[model samples]
Target: MPHTNPASPILQLRGAQVAYGQIQAVKGVDLDLFAGELVSLIGANGAGKTTTLNAIAGTLQLSGGSMSYGGDSIAGLPAHKRLRAGIALVPEGRGIFTRLTVEENLRMGAYTRKDKAEIEADMQRVYELLPRVKERLQQVAGTLSGGEQQMVAIGRALLSRPKLLLLDEPSMGLAPLIVEKIFEVIHTVMKQGVTVLLVEQNANLALGYSNRAYVMDGGKITISGSGQELLHDPKVREAYLGEIA
Candidate 1:
């Protein structure tokens, strides 16, 4: 486990609200993420975890409240601008370009950077982190297995050199072994000074791997506590946790 300071949060949200036309998905959710930490958001279907992450990544506009990154307001910034500001999101379903080769997909991740030397360096770094991706460099993304595709998605996100990585369900549609591998990569990313905000359906995996976790339901955050605390909560045990009688 990495040393996590109890003080200082890297990103903070205050009374954040979001909507899609007439459908309001989030209702004044508050969250805090610190540097070099892995925080998780776990809840059942329609819990609004994805909506919250989309708000932070600027993929969706916030209807009310404020979002600050590294102590600066970025509410007016667009998604690409947010990417330049050191934020990257690996959305759900491993949003990889199926038509592209694995290596080409990685290249697309660094499209924002023009420095050839740095871009190549990042490619090598990602390959080192996920050696399987190296073997499939020439393979088409759509042809790869579900787990392999997820690795490519994560590697692509890392190419952005983000300070904050917003991942929505890195463990979806894969075997337990594959899920473990994904978590290992996420741990490695945190060590590289890239904070991770994970939204996962697997409550057990999320709580076990994160320092702290939050639970969302009915368009609101209902619980926020240390990972172990939430994992041990009576209600959490019955609902999200699985050690029931």
Candidate 2:
């Protein structure tokens, strides 16, 4: 299991709800993430996992409920403010800048910061973590393979030095081997003191790397527990792990 601080969570959500016009996406969901822990939100397609993540990242405003980060209410904070406060989201579909070189895309992650020396240091660190990105630094981001683009996307997020990293469907549309590599990098991020909330469709893989996980169904959290607990759960097995009960 991943090590987690017993102190108050770095991120907390209570009775959170999000709506688009008359359609509600996330409903009354509560979650907590302690420092240095890797937590996952897993569900079937359209279960509101992505919406919940967006709410946390301040990309999608919550129609109801409250969110607190680092003990301060952030319901009114904008996405850029949230990013400055150490919240970074690597959205699904690998949102890389197609027109930019790989190096330029990575540099964009630090646009909020003026700390030139630290930024360069962080850039070096990212290169160490993702050497493949270094190899294609001058290459156009759009020309990279899916796996490489995903790597660049993650490296870009890490450049922000986030305290809370939100990843949505990182394993989607990648080869199995590449997916494994991505998860390995995520684990490394957690070990370096970043709290991670991952939204994944791969339940087994998510649970395997998670310290804890929540099961979302129809915009509500149906169950939550330690990773090992949910991994062996009969319901989780039957529904997500392709196991017959």
Candidate 3:
């Protein structure tokens, strides 16, 4: 369930914009994410969903507008600084280090933290959540299957102990069962008090898990509603859910 009480948003964006040379990817977008809510940004390919996530993660700089996290302006923060500030991004394509072992990959997420004991406890939690990743701990990450790699990618992000998790296309290029498993992990993460901002291509799945959702078209947000509201919306159904109106 979404948080209903009035509280400051964990993250807020006002008129946020991004560009690639002259090509504007995200245009004047405003978004808010409250603590402990699962929010989804859904759209077709090239609709600027990924760009929005990147901008929030500090991987890409905004050409215009303002962004704040935890009530503090962070438009000028760098990617590593954002990560250290409890914002972790599981970027598109997993972004795992191919040559590293699974354990090494997971360890990389905790690089910013110096707390050894807490890190080990978090690693145990990840193993419990993803037993397959534990089984592949000694194996090279490059040799893992797509599903396993995705697990590793998620587990690595978890090890960061982030307050906000930015997931970009986490369901991409995976089997149905794998996608289900990935969403399960996301649900568990949300239950554990981590706020999630998901950019997903699967509208039905994304909305099913989201507390609220936004629809983006051609670099602009066209609709916003509760997950259930959007799921039943005629326009949303016709445009994104493959349903005839």
1 versus 2: better TM-score goes to: 2
Candidate 2 regions exceeding 4 Å error are 2-4
Residue-level lDDT for 176 in candidate 2: 98
Better of 1 and 2 by lDDT: 2
lDDT of 2 by residue, 150-189 (tens): 9999999999989999999999999999999999999999
**How does each model score on TM-score?**
0.95, 0.98, 0.98
Instruction: Give the lDDT of residue 175 in candidate 1.
Output: 99
Per-model tally of clashing residue pairs: 0, 0, 0
Model 3 lDDT-worst window of ten: 1-10
Tens-digit lDDT track for model 1 on 158-226? Answer: 998999999999999999999999999998898778899999989988888888888998888899888
